[model samples]
Target: MERLQKVIAHAGVASRRKAEQLIVEGKVKVNGKVVKELGIKVGENDRVEVEGIPLEREEPVYLLLYKPSGVISAVKDDKDRKVVTDFIPYIKQRIYPVGRLDYDTSGILLLTNDGEFANALMHPRYEVEKTYVAKVKGVPSRESIKILERGVVLEDGKTAPAKVKVISFDKRKQTTILEITIHEGRNRQVRRMLEAIEHPVLKLKREQYAFLTLSGLSTGDSRELSPHEVKQLRALVLHGKNRA
Candidate 1:
């Protein structure tokens, strides 16, 4: 037997939270009976349906979104702010973001309803590498770069070592594009690191995460991840540390 919400999520109905909402709203039925309780259990012999459609356990769905600036990386925002879900129209499942992007930060963000996969990706032990491109106020000195590459003391103490590469310097634009790769997903770590070195980031965009990239997707748009992409992401979570 499995929890109803878990079954609903595994069937690609929604995230566990949303599935519970569906249950509470009397939209989900099991074995031809409406179920409104959150912790109701079900077995393989039972039948489940949502909104009149019989639910089937789908192959786990994954998506890569080119999250635009000024959008919150949350499934729902109480303040009525623009959320990443606003751009994903075709995804009927209640998938949530694997990690997060700041309201003003844009780049590759993963969305999925697979609970175990989400746990593995977000867990600190995984240490999945995330790469970002930051447009900063000024070109950082070699010493500054070294300090960032080595590690800097944030309010939370010393940060993990990150890989910093000065991609290009534009004197005319008075901006520098630097690439930073880090394994830990601290809150606003990239921006804080740059701030610590006196290089405030003007704009930031994540370019890659482990095996996934925001290659073909445009800003404010998303695509359902192919099966191969989903498998690759799962592999990254399962074996990322070994390769890292």
Candidate 2:
């Protein structure tokens, strides 16, 4: 048995903090009896309801979304702008984004109801690699490439070393597309790194994170991860420390 608030939170009804409030408000019930105690225990066999609607234990859900440009990576937007959750109308679990993507950037984004899994993927200690394809204003000089390989100083401080490679160059357009791999998830790291090298990024899209990819997924579309995919992700989080 577990605390009612924790059980509700684990079932994705709400966060643990919010669930406690609901219990105090006397809006939650177990086995047809109103339960207002914050520390009340609940078992898997117990029936739970909130606001008269029966609640079921939520199964873990993991999804990959090809987030399009102009959408914020949040569950709710106070500004009323489009959010990543808008594309996932069918997901029943109260999941949240694993990490953030800039409003103008596009590509692979992971969403899950498993907080432990999300923490593992987002934590820098795991050092999960995120790959991005960036279209920059101009080709970076050899020295600049070395600077990036070693590490470049952003406005904040020196960034961690990143793997940079020229994917292709468009001479006529005066643009160069580069593939960059970084382990840190600092805000706008790719764009800032390119700016530091005097080559402003025109477009950026994350293509992969660790073992997850955007392959077979289209922009603005989302799909539940397969069982194998979910298992692989959990393993990545649990064993990432050892691997690192």
Candidate 3:
């Protein structure tokens, strides 16, 4: 069963908010009866109609879109900037990003229409790891890496300890490539962490999330999640709950 407004929006009639307004106006009918209640739930065989027209049900969609830097991570950007949704024009479902990516950061991003799966993935207890490869202004010494591993003080609070490894150093360019992984999703965290250590980031890109990797995916491309991949992701979230 699903919320009437959600089902209506899923049929591409209108957004969820608009659907709610339509319901309040008594324009929605289910099983040949008007339903004005906001909390109403309709089961799979229920006959749902909006303005006497039947709604078409679409299967849930899960997709991975390589978010390019400068694209906003929102369903619709008020600034008229391009959004991640623009990258997947072929998909018709009202899918949303699971979490978020910075407007200046690029890499692996997950989009889905399944609210339960998104909740499971974003829920703090899951401790899903997000990994990034960062190019910094200068090489970080062992002491600095240790400090990042211990956690840094931010405006909100101290961040969770992160795993940091120096991938390479280029003396000529006075830069270092570091692979940093953290379980917490803070705003501009990787760049902030590097800046806190006096080695500002030149470039940053998320390479992995949980067990999912951006293998062979160039920025701006997207693909549907395979059934097995979806199963594994759900299992990971459920296992986290079991442990809790």
- RMSD values, in order shown: 5.7, 4.8, 4.7
| Tens-digit per-residue lDDT, 106-126, candidate 2 | 999999886556766787777
Index of the highest-lDDT prediction: 3
Q: Each model's TM-score?
A: 0.77, 0.79, 0.80
Tell me how candidate 2 scores on lDDT.
0.87
Q: Report model 3's TM-score to 2 decimal places.
A: 0.80
Model-by-model lDDT, in order? 0.86, 0.87, 0.87
lDDT of 1 by residue, 86-159 (tens): 88878777778888989999999988877657766777677888999999998789999999989999999898
Q: What TM-score does candidate 1 get on C-alpha atoms?
A: 0.77
lDDT of 3: 0.87
Per-residue CA lDDT of model 3 for 1-244, tens digit only, reads: 8899888766656667778988999999999999999999998899988888887777878899899999998889888999999999998888899889999899999998765577668776877889999999987889999999999888888888999988999999899999999988878888888999999988889999888899878999999999999999989888888987
Tell me which residue pairs clash in candidate 2.
none
A best-first ranking of the candidates according to their lDDT comes to 3, 2, 1
